[model samples]
Target: MRHSQADTILQDSMAKRRIKEVTDAVTHESPVKKHLENLLENKVELEQVLAQNSNIDQLVKAAGRVQPNPVETITTIDGIHPVVKKKSGIKKSQIVYDNDYIDVDYDTKNQPFRHVEQDDCKIPNFANTWNAIVDMRQSKKAPVDTMGAHCCADETQDRPTYEYQTLVACMLSSQTKDSVTAAAMDTLKQRGLTIENIAKMPEEELDSLINKVGFHKTKAKHIKQATDIVIEKYGGRVPNTVEELVKLPGVGPKMANLVTQLAFKRINGIAVDLHVHRVANRLGWVKTKSPEETRIKLEELIPKKLWAEVNHLLVGFGQTMCVAAGPGCSTCAANKWCPVGRAAVGK
Candidate 1:
């Protein structure tokens, strides 16, 4: 309390110097600062680890939006993959998934980048196999060849009636054998299946007429309803395009494609049914699970000019040689090109 001015000044100067020393230590060499710098360095290391593996990088980026930089060193580990033994001579370390004996180029250092060699099992040689099938079709005559949508009309019938009959036949052929479908068409012809008579006939009576065919009851209703639409909306002419043909009740893509081809002589698409589906896969022309998938795939492979003939050839081949239960692989000319056939015959 009784200090002199010079003593107070010296004490103040000492206090200022001590505060500066504490500030400098906190800013440059504190434990908290070191911890933060260590954390930033670890984060860069983590980013580098993620950037090295694309799979991990994707997972990290998805979780944290981390834009990892290009890294030379991988400081992380990938998931353990089972050791798969194969005869294709691919480096076991490079393959993480099933390669199906396909020779894939391996990068010894990179876990992400890979190149797959083209394999015959991946896709078909369609043109060569297609030619083989057509050649086989020359000697064979199937139920479809005589009883298909194309053969529904006699020479005496007018154009509109012929087109309508062809549409009706295509519609009836779904899920029904060609023989059964032919019988149904014959009965309809015997019953004078004019559009006027069919339009007015009771569904029950019509079903009784086509009772032998599959799903005759619903088909009876569809026939009457579709005929009404044809008469009312299309002036009794069948819709010429696949777009318009598919509008009718019970009319699907298969029926629509066939109707357009046979009725209007315009091949819009491949009409894949059970036969085409089976034969296409059995011959390795396509690898599909459904007729629709086969239809789409076939269109991509087959040129537009050959679209009309493909269904016919494939159908006949299916009915004659490639029957669902027991395909005649030994006798089949395409067996050499067919994977399933070649395997079946042990060639």
Candidate 2:
């Protein structure tokens, strides 16, 4: 087999091995220590499989600096070096959100669309809009209120599996509407949404399940890769911190922030989806164009106590009344205070 394909197979085998080792270690007196020792002891089993391949040395040499060692012995399959850099002038792939860290080449063709920078985003009575939205939402229900990622799965299930489902729902929700995301999650839950099940499922089948959601193909690949990492690196548990969660494939700052908030209940940052971005701008709460800018600005302005509720509140408002099309400025609760609302109504 080609080196790239073989490398993938090697990583998959080792990840499964690690999962089995973890399950076996749970019965031992020292679970953590026993898991580590068992992993080391059983790593040679991977080599025995690789040794059976007569062309294993060629595969190892051609593998370059990738996961699962790629060294001659192939015993330490999980030991990996940094990936070799691609040749210069290759257009770097773009990522979601206003990410400044990753070097994904956000070239013109692949660049994510940015929000239109408003000329005047400051409104004097903006403080009243928060109360207005809170009052307005109490009487009506929006799609986000009913079908958000928080409602995607049965949380009463096992902790690890439920957490993994939470992460998957967040990933699928990106660039997709809440209703679509909830539906997709429902289908996956029927088929089993656990990490081990998702990791082993063929990417084609997983993609077909979530096909209604936007960018299903990309999300499916990312879900599979992330499940493997969660098992191999995190012992089948989802990473709780923003820093670690963002390291997963297809997870950007937005998804990472939401995962930390919803899955882990660790309120570190606001998840600024399109609804949050539009609502923040329409209320004149933030002048920024992009969601990332909105998130950073909102973080500074909103109190820590309200951080968790901001996204849900604004997303509902934007999704229901303060829509992207002709908004209901006249009848809306914030019409009296919101600058955009007043402008729309010619007040």
Candidate 3:
């Protein structure tokens, strides 16, 4: 059918608008299409440069010049794309440049917008999570003192400011439940747990008092040796710094950092135990295999101001709701926003 000039112009305008809409959708929706557009633009720019240059050497140099935003060339087939760094062993789908063409070999399972383990993910809003868990567990008392052994040591007044007692409590609490450690401390209190008393107390007697805890016999021996060293070297004073605290028998980064924080009121670094390590990984805060590694990573990621609160908040959260075995996911306050909890509950 023959159309009038005005009608033909309107129809052409509509066709152009439709093409624009489709092009925009493809550019935004498909990674492959976007990559193609970039390649085409670069090709056109390269041709223009080559057409203007007469010298082959100059053209080669110009062609080799890097673009302002260089395209990430994927060279591995293990689902890792250079677009973003993934946590260890996480699978990803990405568009790769393959022999002058684009290919999409994504996992097809992971939603693009869904949160996963990526370096670009936001730092955890732990303050809000801490507040939520506090509200959740408010009715019930925290599984232990917020400060663990340090609490017991502080309560022992009228006994020559027993800083060594605080150190002993921290060392004793390792791998031992808070209640068990507290009970052992009570026994020590009754037996007059001072350097003078511990130095004189027979190893067998110390073992019997703390036997309820795990590895009590070995811990008892360590306590005796550590006590002797403290009395002999530091004149019966527990060292205030992490370097000196770690020198005590049975003390590690966890004990050293905790004692420095609670006993000495110095926050040298983050304290990572089994609970802290497990919870941090599950929350996608840090990917590490050991508590020591977790401590190091967390110190780098977490703000200095939040360092003191991480241990207490995570420990309490771990004990009350985010337990190692069969956590109370249904009643957990952070479950709604927690990625690990959501995945576990299949939401």
Q: Which structure among the candidates has the greatest lDDT?
A: 2
Model 1 TM-score relative to the real fold? 0.63
Global lDDT of each model? 0.62, 0.65, 0.60
For residues 1-347, could you state the per-residue lDDT of candidate 3 as single tens digits?
A: 12243244234555335433433444222223222222222333223333454333443333333321212222111111123344333222433211111122221112111122233224666555555665665555565534376566744454334677878888788767898888888889888878889999999999999998766876899999998898899888777766566657677657877776666566777778878988888877788866766776787776555566667667767887788765776777777667787777776
- The C-alpha RMSD in Å for every predicted model, in order, reads 29.5, 17.9, 25.9
Model 1 over residues 34-92: C-alpha lDDT tens digits? 22222222333233333443333242223332222211000011111113354333332
Task: Please give the range of 10 consecutive residues that has the lowest summed lDDT in model 3.
Answer: 72-81
Q: Alpha carbon lDDT of residue 248, candidate 1? A: 85
Order of all candidates by lDDT, from best down to worst? 2, 1, 3
In model 3, the clashing pairs are 93-106
Write the number of the candidate with greater TM-score, choosing between 1 and 3. 1
Off by over 4 Å in 3: 1-124, 154-160
**Tens digits of per-residue lDDT for model 2, 91-183:** 112112222221212121122222212221233454566667777776787888778887786777898887888899999998678899999
Segments in model 1 whose C-alpha atoms lie over 4 Å from true places: 1-125
The TM-score measured for candidate 3 stands at: 0.62
